[model samples]
Target: MTDPDGPSGTATAVPEPPEKAAGTRGRRRALRHPLARFLLRRVLIAVLLAWGITVVTFVLTNLVPGDPATANLGQRALGDPAIVAQWRQDHGLDKPLPQQYLIHLGGMLQGDLGVSQQSHRPVSQDLAETVPATLELAGAAIVVSLILGVAFGVVAALRRDRLPDHVLRVLSLIGISVPTFWLALVAFYVFFYRLQITPGSGRIDPGLQAPPPVTGLATVDSALAGQWDVFASAVGHLLTPALVLALYTIGLLTRFTRSAVLEVLGQDYVRAARAKGLPGRVILFRYVLRSALVPIITVAGLAFGSLLSGTVLVEAIFAWPGVGQYAYKSATTLDLPAVMGVGLVVGGVYLVINLIVDVLYGVIDPRVRLQ
Candidate 1:
């Protein structure tokens, strides 16, 4: 029905069809699901946490004993006070605290991490180059932790107080007790120096130069460059650090998984699963494994985050070039910007990994999405 007063297109401005209306409502409801809401909240929190990390790092790094510019001058610029002061003014280090914060925040928002006084390179570039190496180490460590840790945990749960369980308990305790630096020292010395077998330290052997950066990770970049020999050397270098990191994490992961799985194993669902005549492997792997996933994921995320900051001793011991090593060097040398940058990035990783873990909760347990 046309109306003379109606605007443009259809004179009556025909209403949406009821079927289409229902479809729109359904789509809206799906978007408004609890999981969707939870994920949205997690994202917001992560952003806030990242900002907080940046702020804290910014403030603390500046709060160090010496001024950024003056300290940067060191023995070289000791003769030129006026030049140092001019440099400080030019870098905005002489600005008021609030102004400095604002400038830093603006820089961050623009993805500019600013320059590192020590390296004379932009912080963003330094991070972009260094992070891949750490990530490769982290990835390998996590893989080892997840595989061996979860496997041992399941074995302990299944075996209870048997020899396997007892042996693992001792191993876990020993792993937990071993200092990172100590383990790394022993591993390096015995394997590299004493035995004269494995390559002692660094990402690659002395004579073997890796192909030009592809992934920035020696192992990955080597593979990409079709240098399998370099990749193999990288793996060997990776073994000690990965094992050290994994051993420490494995104890926590294994113990947590053991308890979680053991708890779920006693649940009625397991009995019902058994009664249904499902194979033992199927029941354990499907029903039990699914239920235990949340706790396992929790530990894995924590371990991964810990590994980022956790590598100082490992890197120092093995001369591995990583973020942890950078932080350690920065701290020892009073390179506040580098130290703070590492802290901010590491803290941000923790926040992001935790968010990812929370998202996994919905995936591993559908009940999280029901509400």
Candidate 2:
């Protein structure tokens, strides 16, 4: 301005300084909605946690008693120093532990899970072939768990102190108390051996020609390939193990859901909805059940994650080719790289599931989003 005070004003309106203008733009660019920021924070934390888990797994595998080279080469090579040395050098086992860890971490980052000492194939490939099997089994189990658990829970809640509630409670208690391995064995004995109603073991009947390995999940791939016989066989083989794995989750979810629904039914809003001439079923489903979903979701997510990793025994019992079975073999043979790979994958699964649950929390309850 030519003068600090003009005729029409005490001071002419000064244009914002370039620095101030740029700063304002920067702040505007930096600002993000609360939900976006929250999600970003969670993702960062999950990444860090996954890395920590990998490191711990690596260290623990290294600390194990057996030498990987010896495990790989066996006693015959143990007698030959040259062979052992060559094996160690070839696999990078000759390097220092920290250097090995770094190399392993780098390879993992690039999606190379290293070669299996026992199988002599890419660990990632092995997991790729097996993980789908586990996923299929776990997926079936979860569906069963959710349907039965929620149904029984709702029935128990509705009937309160009736005979059906008592019977459900008793059954849930038994389900929780029974060991998974024992259940799997008993199921096999009763359903497969004695009754012969289900297939004995494996993912499909050997007599049935398998469909092309499209998804590595026999049932899904067979269905996709229009191979109904293979699909039927896969389903028959899967039923027993899936049911066994689902039982524990069903019990836990049933009890939790029952308690949660009971608590919600006693709430003021639920009673208010009922008093306002709302249909009983509508109030129960829309108000009571929706309010009770948070805990149920939490448990379900955790259960699915657990099923992914904890099905080793069940997989072994059922002879299902899954990551759990692979992990078992690797651990028994002290295959460090394979074991480490499984650990990373399992831990990553758990973290990812928890992240999903957290996101669901925000979606289901807007208050969580605002926070």
Clashing pairs in 1: none
Q: Write the per-residue lDDT of candidate 2 for residues 1-371, one digit (tens) a residue.
A: 13222333422366566786566555444445666766877888998998899899999888888777766676888899999999889889999999999999999999998999889899999989888899889989999999999889989998999999999999999988899999999999998899998898889888888788887889889999998988889998988899999999999999999999999999999989978999998998899998899999999998897677658999999999899999999998888889998998888888988898998888788899887
Against the reference, the lDDT scores of all candidates come to: 0.81, 0.87
lDDT of 1: 0.81
**Displacement of the residue 181 alpha carbon in candidate 2, Å:** 0.8
- Give candidate 2's error at residue 232 in angstroms: 1.7
* Residues 33-98 of candidate 1: C-alpha lDDT, one tens digit per residue: 788777877798888888889888888877778655655676667668888878787667788988
Instruction: Give TM-scores for every candidate, taking all chains together and pairing residue i with residue i.
Output: 0.88, 0.88
TM-score of 1: 0.88
Task: List runs of model 1 lying over 4 Å from the truth.
Answer: 1-30, 33-35, 75-80
Candidate 1 scores a C-alpha RMSD against the true structure in Å of 5.0
Q: How does model 2 fare in lDDT?
A: 0.87
The positional error of residue 66 in candidate 2, measured at the CA in angstroms, is: 2.5
